[model samples]
Target: PDMRAAEDAGARNAQLTKPPGALGRLEEVAIWYASWRGDPRPRIERPQVVVFAGNHGVTARGVSAFPAEVTAQMVGNFRAGGAAINQLAQAAGARMDVVALDLDRPTADFTEEPAMSEDEVVAALAAGWQAVDPEADLLVAGEMGIGNTTSAAALAAALFGGAGGDWVGRGTGVDDAGLARKAAVVDEGLALHPQAKDDPLEALRRLGGRELAAMAGALAAARAHRIPALLDGFICTAAAAVLEKASPGALDHCLAGHLSAEGAHGRLLQALGKAPLLDLGLRLGEGSGAALAMQVLKGALACHSGMSTFAEAGVSGG
Candidate 1:
């Protein structure tokens, strides 16, 4: 049952095939999973993507070119069966769940914005957990919220340990002026939540959007259920990084979907010691990248399970 033994078996299987490297990265991914699982055969079952939606506080400061109302509009779009996430999920044939999390809104009608209580955060997370099948083999978490990039940037800055400003990036099209304002907002938010200076949960409460906090909870639940989780884009990866810090070994089930244009996303991947499957300069959120990556994963698993080794195929190789 040793992974090394399984890898040896997989390599022999590849050698038996008619062409070398014909399968490209698929061959490598199959063998890697084989070794990781300690089995010649590995299967990815019950792939699901959870898209968490919420509102962010920084949007009130015009951090993004789009209006804050877009968050609710996009949510409705997702519910009505349109949007990039819907297309990507359909393409990947993954079950998609869209959850609406009621967090502090940048556009809330109040003299003072109310901070989300731990109980509300936990309850939202619990609902997210219930939305998916506990037996899913792979889970992908996506986020939808105006100004979430600002929230994610703030979380990344606080968690940067030493590299804060270097990791922050513009979300949803911001000009130079907007970027500066965004960074300042993140800096201020981090200062306001000193208790979360190094704490993930406190950071979530302080700088995280409802979608992000729920995404964290969903990831924790996925880990508890023993399912591999795929991270999509900047916000999702940032959320995963927070959850990882909170629970060591939680990232064992995580797969980096792609290298993102967001600066903080790159830093988070480096911190996590993960290599992304793709790098198309993708800046769009909604699990589009992760859903596309799942197709390659399916191909890899199919090759591992269906292909014959050189000996079995009666192919000759020097």
Candidate 2:
């Protein structure tokens, strides 16, 4: 992020219709977009929501209420424009794309084996990078892997230096017992691949789902393309954690779209130094939070660029 643009935006905001700091986080939103874009009057258009769908072998542990096949099923639903993210994207006026990562190879159970090899992770990342259009104004990366929360929690624990159990969450409406089982599985996976604790890419290779790897890759590509990224919930944050580790300050191009209801999500966002745009107790991770926040960003950009200046409105100035 560019400090000069933010300072310039702050100066510009003070000259707008409202008093200084009256807009609160909306002002911050404008500043952030400006900082990323190096444009005091930044505008967002051509918003795209990319859903990365993959299967998680850990679902065999009965962690999630939905089965692994549901990952593929939801991809179909996303194509049909019937999923929650689809509806949210429609409301937000954003285009949505779904990518199925590693459909040929079955997902490895991280508790027993690496979730994806280095080659697989690299390939998935490349696919994610290619998915982002250079013309995209903003990119929102979402995940649809069953049991991905477990993979995400494991990645968080690995990068953040915590017990896997501490980062685990009930994904897809897992019950108390299912949550416990998910924690145990993540712990065991971490134990099996302990090197992930010190290496971020290693963590993704060992514990991250295909969707997560792709998410991380897409974020890296966004930074390269200078497009701001709006991240979803727990899963998205965890992937961002890995991206941050791989490339320092990578998340400077990203916005924490919302604070998920999952307990670990706050920790991940705090680690990433991001303040979410919305806090609606949203736990759904299919990029729904990001899509909704895109709407808020649109509002913020509109107010920042459209509101008349004090001089233009013939009003008093500070």
Candidate 3:
């Protein structure tokens, strides 16, 4: 991807916009993708949002403020176009797809059982990839799972070579005492899961739910086809990071949506060498933050296409 072309396009358009950098990160996003795609005249075509829902085993340890059933409830809300993510996706002119994998949903038959099998994970990922257009310009990966923060922390610790404490945080307003308990749960889960102690894919197999695995597969598919993706918060980014490690250059197609309230997000983004676009202190998953970031990308694409260069606009140069 030739980012230079996008930058040049952005610079050329600045004179045409009302004020320089007025759009802020929005301008940067458009230019970034333009350069990445080597298209000075970039367009954001058929943006898609994928929300993956699953249940987590670690939630049994009282890690999250919300119950596991909330996962399925939110999925139903998303399908009904009622969640915040749904609103954002609609506002951003994006098509939405909801994926419900039988990872560990509260009402699921295996709610109290272990994670999915390796074959089940592969199938989920395949479905996630199919949820979007193969030629779409961008992909957004969001998650809906109770106690997913625990899974994300463990996965980040394993993939980025850190401890669970490094990635674990007060998810959904867990107090200091709760944080300690969450960390302990993460530590124990990490110790017990063989995948968490070994290869990233194998680790995902052991600890990851349907949503995370599917996001990983979606990310991999996007990269294989040269399409860029936007990662929403900790869990989504963590899954994306796993996918990146699984296949080199996978991160090339991803943009860190924002700095999540989750503690592990920073270190995970750092490991990927990505700078987030927003810092709204968002902790609620379900792709809300990432959907907001899409607005910025849209503005950037507008700048690329709508803005005129100095020569074209007949503007005087200093």
Candidate 4:
């Protein structure tokens, strides 16, 4: 957000040993850090991953491959440090915390009722923002919920209206029949809450999950704290869309970790005006993409700070 520091980084880049713009997006990533941090040698020493796990009432509609119980099970797994995000966080050397906002007791089905009450949404968001570690140098928000993609698609379709197939995806590797079911659920929810298309907070309360609201709250807090946040795949991105709708430019405090294989992820990224750091065809949630992308940021910082300039290397400019 600091253009002055970014300009200074650009000038420093031009004087580096490599030709200008040779490092590609890694250069841009380094500049992104330099711009916000004003650190000539910025580093992510205290990266953290905060995971919000919950259950969706829409799972009763037969949307995902996994049962809704898996939501609570996985939350237990996260608590025991046994989930994929746990391993990924350990590998990334980031502290991991799992917050169970609404576990086994699902929120009300959005097709039949609101996902959460206004008070619940407010409390979820407050919990999410409060989860952020002020001592952290970087933060990543991840979600774990069965049938969350359906909720994400419904929210995305309402915001960026289109056919159900355009926004829906095969969450948890659902088959054709399950995919159709998921799409139908989204279509039904969108039809039920057409007015939420114009109102973001309403959409979160209507179609989004408590975990999503928490993630959005974390995004807003990161923006307020000037801490760079890494966003996960579809569900996380949809949560970000909520924040962007509620407060414009809230996503400016975050970076997209990856372009997920989900149908609506790219469109959601476009809506947020963010280019993902990686595109490994990832659709697995649980903060895996965020964990993997942190390596890229560390790499960028290492190169930008460790490499010698042309003058220091005694190399003549061409």
For candidate 4, list the clashing residue pairs, or say none.
none
Q: Which ranges of candidate 2 are over 4 A from the true structure?
A: none
TM-score of each: 0.87, 0.96, 0.88, 0.96
Worst 10 residues of 3 by lDDT: 105-114
- Looking at candidate 3, what is the lDDT of residue 169? 91
lDDT of 4: 0.87
Candidate ordering by lDDT (highest first): 2, 4, 3, 1
lDDT of 4 at 272: 87
Top of the candidates by TM-score: 2
Model 1, runs deviating above 4 Å: 1-28, 31-40, 103-115, 162-164
* Candidate 1 residue-wise lDDT, 175-272, digit = tens: 88888877676666666677767788777766776787778878878766756667888898887778778877677667788888976788788888
Model 2, poorest ten-residue lDDT window? Answer: 101-110
Per-candidate total of colliding backbone pairs: 2, 0, 3, 0
User: What would the per-residue lDDT of candidate 3 be over residues 148-202, giving only the tens digit for each residue?
Assistant: 8887787787787656677789887788888888777667666676456558887
**Candidate 3: where are CA atoms >4 Å away?**
2-28, 35-38, 103-114
lDDT string, candidate 4, 20-129, tens digits: 88889889888888777766567778888999987889988998899888888888889999988999888888999899985857888999988999998898899899
